[model samples]
Target: MNLFQDIRALVIGALEIMQADGVIPVGLDFANVTVEPPRDPAHGDMATNAAMVLAKPAKMKPRDIAEALAGHLAADYRVDTAEVAGPGFLNLRLSPALWQGLVKSVLSSGEGFGRSTLGAGQRVNVEFVSANPTGPLHVGHTRGAVFGDALASLLDHAGYDVTREYYINDGGAQVDVLARSVYLRYLEAHGQEVAFEDGTYPGEYLIEVGEALRRKVGDAYVGKPEDVWLEPIRDFATDAMMGLIRADLKSLGVEMDVFFSEKSLYGTGLIEQALDALDAKGLLYEGVLEPPKGKMPDDWEPREQTLFKSTEHGDDVDRPVKKSDGGWTYFAPDIAYHYDKVSRGFDALIDVFGADHGGYVKRMKAAVSALSDGRVPLDVKLCQLVKLWKNGEPFKMSKRAGNFVTLRDVVELVGADVTRFVMLTRKNDAPLDFDFDKVLEQSRDNPVFYVQYAHARVCSVQRKAQEAGIVVDDAMLAAADLTKLDHEAEIAVAKKIAEWPRLVEIAARTHEPHRVAFYLFELASDLHGLWNKGHDDPSLRFLQEDDVDTSQAKIALARAVAVVISAGLGILGVTPADEMR
Candidate 1:
């Protein structure tokens, strides 16, 4: 099914034969030897650098090794010809039978065709969209949500045991501000006008929470002191905000396997336990931090504080874990959170943070490294900002989200599918422009539309073939006389299908789901190219009126393209279109 992988094995086997024949030295490293598609299709179907890579190590001329390797490779049935190019590169022309066999592989595998076992069932925890439970999720959180969800799905497709988690920022001063904001709305709900000054959330969404609080507790806590109302209201307000966040994520088709509360780390002795784990490693210390790096803060002063030896693990400087008053800093709970992840026996941990949190990466990684004794690896992906556009104009801000574009705004404006797909058009570290006009367009320039249209075209072929009274189910396609598919354009499409499994592993390895979007775009372009070629050549068409076998064979290839497209889209959390609207 993986043609390149199979051919690389063949190349290695041929090299081993060369070693046996004294053409090359014994125990030459074949690890760097690679068989991949030629940079230019004019050369051949595949190219290998085995000759060039082994030349210096074996103390032989590259051409001599390439010529010897080519002879051995050409004797294989799958390799039609192996031509030496330049000094050492070996270009290979695989037989049409290999491409034809890939179509059968596609039909047999269906959506599972491109799934990979590269991860080997390694447990990975993906923490994403951990926005503070203070308000509705904004545009930045939307990008993180889509990126994290798609990443989790991609890792799952690559055979990783992925746990999607959300860390609730409910233990901070921010949630206290939210409680006061809700209390303001509660007073307003009681027919007393209240002014929302600075440091309080003034969004109208909290008005409902206030009204609901009134329904829950009739006329109680209306005139209570801050101490009497602060703690209980903080719990109630955070839960309300979390409910709103859940609804927003639900609108965009995102769900978390775990919603961990930061407050739980406080009272449960978890934070102390996590820091103690680091302390046992001799990573904790009492030290004096230098003044703020660039420009000193107005209140800058030196004070001895409890710090973590983050610099020993890779951070730029030691980080303070406790303030002068012995209160935990923001970094302490984060360390505890990652400690919980590491202790849960996950093979790896991934954090999807906003670009603004770029400074937090090394410290968090240092914490995980120290806590897990370097046994667990942590990867942090920073999701950049998303700028919205509509009709060649900047999209209006949301009053509902207090001047920021909400996740629901983007989903409701276009749709969840378009929203998710467009969000991943760029890498997580790159800024993305989500244009309402451009993304919803049915034109081919829109990648989502083009890929969806390709899937729909294959569906159209199935409908026409069914109405023509020719059986086009997967069983029949898999059993078709695929040797009839010998056209150049037809073979090209099959070759693209062969790269799907490889693409999945590459994307999963890089932790970049944007590669899947790019690959799907390329696959759709190939499928579209073949469909266009059919118009000029009647024999190239997928459906033939008289020949049932020939039509089934060509239609079989088209169906395989749809199958792979659906599989790739599934990894991206996109529902493939059966018929374009």
Candidate 2:
């Protein structure tokens, strides 16, 4: 069903024939040979750099090889003509029937048309949104959540066994601050006045957790010291904050398959086991690190510390595993977590981190490389900041979240579909401006609305055709005489539809789900363009008042567009709109 792939196979077969016939040298690497759409549509339907890439390797002139290859390719039934252009590139003009058949293939495949086997069923664990369990998720976390969820879905569609996971930063000093803050609220709930200190969380969301704590304990530790209540309260507060975070993610339709606690890595001998694996490979040592670049700190001193030879695995320098005081550093647990992932037998690991975590990328990759002995590859995607705007000014912060806008605030303002779609409208590492007013506006500038409207318009066409007593189901349209779809404008849409399967593989290979959003917008534009063309040319309309055969053929093309859009939106974790409201 992948026309481009099918054609590429034909090109490869023809090149092999050239080799057998002694027209070109044998054993020229064809791995770099590619067949894709030409840069300018006027050039041809498809272009291949086979001759150019093979020229130097095959020890032959590119033009001579291209001319010989073109003769072989033109004999195929699918190729109408193969011409050499610009000194070596072979351009192909496929038969119009090929494009017509692509529309039928789309109708036959439905939403599964673009699904791929790029991952080949390999197991991949995607860990993201590992925010500290101390408060509701804010706007920054929302970007990471949406990007990670969409990437997981894209990989799933591209045939990867993906597991969505969240890492809980519960074993940290921040959670202790959360416990003290909840205790203040707990005291306030018992009709006692309390003031939130500078280091404590002052968000009103913790008020309910404090009230719930009173309900559970009945002031059992109201006057107790920190030693007796800190542990219990810290556990209780983390649970409450995680619950709030779960609700926030649910509002945006994100769900994780696993929630791993950082505390679980501690006291379980997991850190020791992970380091032992590294130590066995002679990666661990006791050394003093050089002073950090720039003006040295006042207390800077050379002290012996447990270090991992991260530089051997591509990190900028060796990293510390344990401090001089014998306490584990922040990175120790992260190393253990990735080791756990590798030990679970996953073929690969992907970590979705915020842009601020950019500095941690090389070291984390080095840790996984050393732990897995380079058996498993790690891909880290860093999502940049999202700026909120409204009324031509910066949006106000959420009172519920204390100092930043919560995910729920954005979801409630527009909707889950809009929030998810808008979040992915940009590259994950590029800063995004989420303007409340512009996103909601019904214009081409709004990609979510534009793509959704195209799907809705197709639905409207189906409804009108059904009212006209036309049988327009997928089976009927798929079996229609698609040769009647001969207009250049109509063929242009089918050509775009043919690129879906290729685009899916590209986006999945690059781990960039924003490419899907961008492709959907372009497809929508092509669909909208064809729809407008129908206004001036009565013969181009989907319904021909007196000819059912031609009408079904044109309607079949429109339905094909809907099928691809639905599949694209599905990969983005957004529902395809059946109608615009």
Best by TM-score: 2
lDDT (10s digit) by residue, model 2, range 431-508: 999999999999999999999999999999999999999999999999999999999999999999999999999999
Q: State, as a TM-score between 0 and 1, how close model 1 is to the true structure.
A: 0.98
Cα error of candidate 1 at position 557, Å: 0.6
* Candidate 1 lDDT tens digits, 479-555: 99999999999999998888888888889999999999999999999999888887888999999879999999999
Estimated TM-score for each candidate: 0.98, 0.99
> Model 1: number of clashes?
0
Over 4 Å off, model 1: none
Flag regions of model 2 displaced more than 4 Å.
none
Model-by-model lDDT, in order?
A: 0.93, 0.95
By summed lDDT, the worst window of 10 consecutive residues in model 1 runs over 397-406
Pairs that clash in candidate 2:
none
